[model samples]
Target: SQTIHQWPATLVQPVGSPLSLECTVEGTSNPNLYWYRQAAGRGLQLLFYSVGIGQISSEVPQNLSASRPQDRQFILSSKKLLLSDSGFYLCAWSEFVAGAVNNEQFFGPGTRLTVL
Candidate 1:
């Protein structure tokens, strides 16, 4: 069975501080990984994605950056946190079959960040 894990289920931080969020996938090989964020009352927005190690694509130009150090591990980081950065961060992995474009995404439990 495949499983994804995210650390620090909840976080509260002040402005101008650095932030780091981690996600790791188990029991899968070379799966596509992604990072997403959801505001207090908004839809999920994709932040970053990686098809392979060191191959990342950013969907938005924000203070957040993502990295895939290993085949199944992804990390999201920031140099400074902003009030607008408060949200639920999600990490997801997906598998594509036969080169299909619309693959179903499997999400891990998210990290809720609160900027105070």
Candidate 2:
């Protein structure tokens, strides 16, 4: 079975501070990893996705970045946190081995970031 883990279920930071969030998968190899942000009471927005190591696609250009350092480890970073950046951050994964376009996304519980 595959499982995804995200750290710091909740976070509170001041404005203009740096941020880092991590996600990792177990029992899977080369899975497609994604970072998503959900504004309060809003739908999800894709932030970045990585097909492989060092290959990331940014769906939106914001004050954030993503990186895949290993087969199952992904990281999201921001140089400075904006008040607008405060939201629910979710890391998701899908089976890359599956030859399907609409693979089901498995999300972590999520990290609620509160910037004040």
Instruction: Write the residue-wise lDDT of candidate 1 on 62-107 in tens digits.
Output: 9989999999999999999999999999999998466789978899
For the record, the alpha-carbon RMSD of candidate 2 to the native fold, in angstroms, is: 1.1
lDDT of 2 by residue, 1-116 (tens): 98999998999999999999999999988999999999975999999999999899999889999999999999999999999999999999988865677888899889999999
Q: Which regions in candidate 2 have their CA more than 4 angstroms from the true location?
A: none
- Model 2 is weakest, by summed lDDT over 10 consecutive residues, at 95-104
Best by TM-score: 2
For model 1, what is the error of residue 47's alpha carbon versus the real structure, in angstroms, after optimal superposition? 0.5
The CA lDDT at 44 in model 2 is 95
Kindly provide the TM-score of model 1 when superposed on the true structure, using C-alpha atoms.
0.94
In order, the Cα lDDT scores of the candidates are 0.93, 0.93
